[model samples]
Target: MKMKLAATAIAAACALPLQASADGEVNIYSYRQAYLLEPLLNAFQEETGIETNVVFAKKGLAERLEREGRNSPADLVMTVDISRINELVERDLVEGIENDTLQNNIPQNLRHPDGKWFALTTRGRLIYASKERVEEGEITTYEQLADEKWDDRICTRSGKHPYNIALFSSMIAHHGEEATEEWLEGLKDNLARKPQGGDRDQIKAIHAGECDIAIGNSYYYGNMLNDENQREAAESVRLVFPNADGRGTHINISGIALTKSAPNRDNAIRLMEFLSEPKAQQIYAEANTEYPANPSVKPSGMVAEWGEINPDDLSLQEIAENRSAAVKMVDRVDYDN
Candidate 1:
């Protein structure tokens, strides 16, 4: 009942005209799902007496903001993936932040150098291997996914997906485009079936015996383990941190940024700082099954059980920069075909 009212309020608020510095309220346009933000927003409201109005969608918030320009009601933008947040800056839709609280909480590697964005939590791009088929220590690196031994044994989503693009971009960053293209072609040759579906679908394919290996985000495995219906499929596979012993696993983030037309700037900043703090960070970590960007806070127990992630130290900006080349390379190699 309480949740319904909150949803009602959020819907009503989203419909009204937005004004700057609307008393005791902050508005947001989020690509992140609403259910994930509800608890965190409610907690912030309870603590500060500031209401949060959110407009959630999977895409187009940036374009909407562009259309509204200065009249945009959004105070903040939150979403997953480096490319999405970088899109905001690339379009000049977000404001640069200079808060000590944000700077202190988020690591340099995880935040934009100019403060155009800050990562709140990170999820690893992991290799999920079939437990019954793939032996322990058999495959240890991202490079191994291209090995001839794994021919006709791999599954993955579309090469154009942001998660995979980031991983591919990282490859270009580390090994140069020529080598990365060769790797992509080899990986494509190894696919058991046409690349389709999200990360979870890749895992499902593995469980159904369509493939012996799949690429997925770490949190998907954790979420599946927690879901009764998905547990069996999830348990059929074991988590492997690709490149853990070398350049470390590729990671992506769920991040937030201040919008240029922040009506209630102060309240938005408060929410940002609150999220970066231990309490909210812990809540986010547990809720999403991601590692907290606030290094001081620990990951949820379920995530910690998976073993530590030795994250690639490569600059995320470099990855974002290489995104075009990565996508082009995906096309050039006919990765999805």
Candidate 2:
């Protein structure tokens, strides 16, 4: 799998160059892997007369755009995580656009304050507890992962990974760095083994009885259930939307922004607006097993069965602002050690 992914990435990079958008065309530089974008792109092209062109890369599109300057062909950038999109804003690679469609479809908290980036779908950083061992209500908040009762029982990936960094950033947004530092230390103490593996491995750990609980994104539940080898392991655990009853779950997005030097600004804006509409959002969210940013669009059947999520009201603006401080706290606590 790793070899195939690396090969695919190399091929993608070899194929990518600054594309010049011609009339009625929009060029996209996306961090999202090709599989996730292909279907949506096809639908988008079919729906509108505008031609769609994409270059997929795992990383470094921002630097490429920077090097290309005003000559860059990218009309828009699509990527996951607030920090990644925020980097474009920080580096002046993307620009804010005032769009009534975005304003209507996306909530204020799920968008850039300056209208630079807008969330397309949301996923929660949630708890996965053993179905046999953890009772309903046994854990209620992200803070509970710190309790000593779970000592030597919890599991996670590296604290420095962007997903965890985003989660930690949210902590800073809510409780400040001092408290977040303490929380990280406690959370670390609960680890059953050294922090390691992707989110699905944590579910496999629960199935293997390596631990009674783990931390992961919500979408993995659907993915694991669909994989024949992972189905049983996925079934052995249940999800907890931590803090759902309080501040609501800590959620993040896969989002997009208009490039600063869009050659086809009008077509790019039209694409953005199309994506915000219910039909496109339905395809985008369902295929990814995520909640659409548009409230009117429902999640897939499997996702809906997991239960509704009430996302935290705290601004992603504040959360993105606190990311650097969050990473520092992880180091201070030696969280992955």
Candidate 2 lDDT at 177 equals 83
User: How well is each residue in 15-60 modelled by candidate 1, as lDDT tens digits?
Assistant: 5545545788888778877788878888888888888876676777
In candidate 2, where is summed lDDT lowest over 10 consecutive residues? 1-10
TM-score of each: 0.95, 0.95
Best by lDDT: 1
Judge candidate 1 at residue 31 and give its lDDT.
80
Count of steric clashes across candidates, in order: 1, 0
Evaluate all candidate structures by whole-model CA lDDT and list the values in order.
0.88, 0.86
**What is candidate 1's local distance difference test score?**
0.88
Cα lDDT tens digits for candidate 2, 1-337: 0101111353555465645768767888788876787677778878776777777787888887888899988898998888898889889888988888899999999999889999999999999999998998999899988999999999898999888999999998889888888888999999999999999999999999999999999888888888899999999999999998888999989999999899999989998998988999999888888899999898877889988998997888789888889888888888888
Off by over 4 Å in 1: 1-21
In angstroms, give how far residue 298 of model 2 lies from its true place.
2.2
